[model samples]
Target: MTIQSSYPYYLANRAVDANRDLEVIDKHTGEVATRVALADDAVVDRAIAAAVEATPAMARLPAHRRRDVLNGCADRFVERFDELAEILLVEGGKVIKDARGEVQRLIDTFRIAAEEATRIGGEVLPMDIAERSEGVLGFWKRVPIGPVSFITPFNFPYNLVAHKIAPAIAAGCPFILKPAEKTPIGALVLGEILAEFDLPEGAFSILPVPREDAARFTEDERLKLMSFTGSDKVGWMLKGKAGKKPVVMELGGNAACLVDADADLDDAVERLVFGGFYQAGQSCISVQRVLVHDAIYDALTERLVEQVGALRGGDPRDPETFVGPLISEDDAKRVVQWIEEAEAAGARRLVGGERDGAVVRPALLDRVPDDCKLFSEEVFGPAMILERFDDFDAALDRINRSRYGLQAGLFIRDIGKIRRAWDRLEVGGVIINDVPSFRVDHMPYGGVKDSGLGREGIKFAIEDMTEIRLLAIREA
Candidate 1:
């Protein structure tokens, strides 16, 4: 399950043994795990040119062939499941169990894309609505939008990369992907699998380039669309530089979960614990705020503290470990400082704020100030804030106070309250009786406001990667 000493970058479906200047660290041990070749500006320009050149071949690729390519990728991923999970655990710092789950999601995403490849259908349009349109027939179908560019983050590397690559393959769009520098192994391995297929030359390239050199990915006029998943600051900056091409972004969020008086306390406690701390709470939709009704606030807080304290933190390779290290020591230090700042500002630290190197124990705080970073910004670590709410409407309003509107969760027995939250919540999706971290591979997933633009499920991404054209006929 160990990775090779060095891996090469892929350009135009061929492996280029360029100099391995970029070193990838094993997050758990803080040791250099492997090195990957880095793509420079010249290489990037060549990749974009290749993608532009291969645009027609990819567009003319039959639907059945596209489905076969995706299906083959799924099969290969299943065959090498353990290897992929191990890479995720070492390079991405995910616990072994969560790493395996992400691998399964990667497979599911490709399978879903395979199914959707053949389903990219067109519709007949009746164009005789007016007298001028008499004897006119029309139809419309989606076509590949040509070369696209993708920039993915380190968290959930496999599945997030799948969300971009799988749909591009399904919609017959050639693309270039620049994976996060912290974690490029998973995407490079995927390039190996993709090269096995007889895809059109220059159909895809997996590059691990420095952030400074990746500006071309956003500014290149040949690239038809740009897809980015990372911090809101960087996503918006790239959008401004993306020129005339369309941009799809899945930026981070500080999601909230509300617990009503009548909700199941046991179920709420269990889900909240997992939602707030899973994978060190690095996900964009990880539950960062828990709004509990006053009647059950004390009880839920007690139970949650016990569970959060009991979570194991150590080597991610251990099967018993639940809490793992953050991506780096600096990130762990940042989380610790934020917690200390909140405590100094009159917030109460309930449990688990200890830190050792990159591993920060899961933390829970009460009465966190609205202006504190922990409460207002995307923590992107294993920390959550607890708040008490008496009125349901006030609680909903509190959740809306933040600039982020990704997703929110509600645990309630009353159907009326569920409907109210559904209507009142400003997020993109509301989960009833569950945590906001819940997501299926096929579900349309994205956020509003500062959380970024556009949906990212396979079908939704396909729509973004393709353009519709109308075929019309007029009878003389």
Candidate 2:
């Protein structure tokens, strides 16, 4: 069955105007499968207006009722998991298995957010008085930051959008979600499913606005918070222009996978292949650097070469296809350019340096010079760069050299080495046994340095989305 929809962008309680048709390209075949509506300034205004109007109802809903509504949305989402997966596969270039995985992650996030809503609590405090008596009483509670703007990126469209929308719903905040233009259908479809429930009209609006106009909306003082998941460059731009509003950005990361001397080579190869090439390596937390302890460096490289060679790039709908086309031909071209630049600067491309249209075969590079572009930057493609270090301290130093501090993984059994790396890695989270991509829904997931500010987990985001208010009373 072909999933067809007319409205491209939904705003403020209605699917207003279908002015522009956003051509959605099937990443696998480079064919246009469907068109989504892109919103204009007028449409954006309507969304903003609706969010403003819905704030009162959002604030008025009791905590328990809000939890019920969020849970209902999650239930509705799980019921249509297959449909959601199909939409994601066609529109976002995610492999069928990964599309299903994203759906499951979204479900987990929603459930976690629902649980968080019920646990939103306040604390009672005792006050010491100098003016009169010691009978003064006080307590503190969290209040929702009204009119939150959620700007989600293209990678993992379904789950990332859910990460933003679910928490906003749980917090009882009116949300204006601006999903990435290239992959808007998945978000719009989810919006339709959400609209089916008795959500107070205008409580949530999904806008597919152009990237240029996105900055304009952030300038609006009516927006209390801006949550973004995208590039580090744009994340900083948001912080600058967000005015007085609070911003929570999940920015870029050149995630590292470290294999110490005591590590298992076979297991490291398995994890690296999955983490480096999944979703075409477009993930913010994708492992971009592979640091080996020089002892098993050559052996690990050979195994990685064998594994990355077998990765299949083709139709995303095919369950057997391990790799799929990138979001666009242009993005693929850019990846190609970056690899070529690295090679020109004296880096040796070991395997998989081919690109056809939007698909690039997974590539591995070694002998990366200090001046090579790939050594210091994120390729954000199915490419991995190898760096060998003899001393443990040197590997830790090299891993922390980059400006991005998102996530890092180390495969080792030495307690002292693990503890030292944990202290020296300078990232948001350190995984001792798993890949950097292993993220649970409730754990605080974020970065440090230029990677991003603030953390994103169900409960953590809720705390960031709200402000504390203390109530005090004394004998009048």
Candidate 3:
């Protein structure tokens, strides 16, 4: 059955067939609820026009006023949390309980961004470089960069969308949000909520367009920035298309989590199970590879095997379910293929190499060869390959060997060893004594190397979104 909201989900340009134009697919039941108008070049042009027209008014709104607008939306979102959670469950294949948490994360992201709005300020710089202008007073003002275009991904649609949308509004920049086509409803509802706050007609726009048309939205010269979160390949391509436009791209992560000899194996195991298998390992920061010290490798693997073996896999709506289906049946088949390739190339699936419908039990592998695709590529599914290392340096070496270095986790008690790992690990964020999956709403979250550029979260992203204009004055 196609689920329809009693209210219209699309905002701004009143196009009736938005639902059909976008082909919004239901990940759980694999059905199309409504065709969301896939923003074509023309729709993108209109959205851009709307945003550009709204930019001046948005910027004129005092930061405190902007906070009020954002907080209003956040309040509505929290009040109707259940409705948003259901949309996440049906559209993203997230289990009911996890789906609810996803909605809460979005709410938290908005609340944080709202608070950050009033805190946007610039610094003063002394004109010491110019001897003639030494007596001049110099200061700087932080202002919005006009219109911003947010292209969010399917995973964590609500929260990630909030990451982009909330900050854009808080920074006094009008936005045109293009949510992932598959999970557009929740984002659309968010835009609708912001609209309820009597925001200027063009303050923000959300269009559920397909991937092919996303570039068209960025093609407009008025789009001052493009904030995106998705796969590395696509993020890079978008960065290139964005030209000189500021781009905040949060890309893929084939993250490594190291378990050292001087660590807590039980805590590491528990966090890994939650991080790796939760969301069916579709998370970018999920523990894709674990580099365990040889001293505790066998013991760690045994506990991991037991924990993974006991996981429940099935209907996402069940609160007790440990694992849910992949985003789609095709994705499930692809994940199976990835595991099969790893096995054929000399990797051993220690447990759970089974699939029923879109649901696949989490699979753990050991002795995965360096030449295997599972080791070399981003296995963005519910499977993590295990590698054994004998020394601290060796573990660090193995962890840094992968091209994607978004975030890394190390379980260690030795301060010296932890410091050494921190020095050597080439990642944007590192978690000591915790798994890589741990991320708070306000932290500077992004990756190094092929993981893309810039950062997310309200504060850092706001810094990237605006340009500073220094002002100097001297008495005549």
lDDT of 2 by residue, 57-95 (tens): 987878787777778878887898888888788778888
Model 3 vs. true fold: TM: 0.96
Higher-TM-score candidate among 1 and 3? 1
Candidate 3: regions farther than 4 A off: 1-19, 128-130
Q: Rank the models by lDDT, top first.
A: 1, 2, 3
Q: Tens-digit lDDT track for model 1 on 342-384?
A: 9999999999989998999999999999999999999999999
What is the C-alpha lDDT profile of model 3 across 345-379, one tens digit per residue?
88899998688878889999998888777788887
Q: Rate the local accuracy (lDDT) of all candidates.
A: 0.95, 0.84, 0.82
Q: Worst ten-residue run, lDDT, model 1?
A: 413-422
User: Candidate 2 clashing pairs?
Assistant: 8-37
TM-score of each candidate structure, all chains considered together: 0.99, 0.96, 0.96
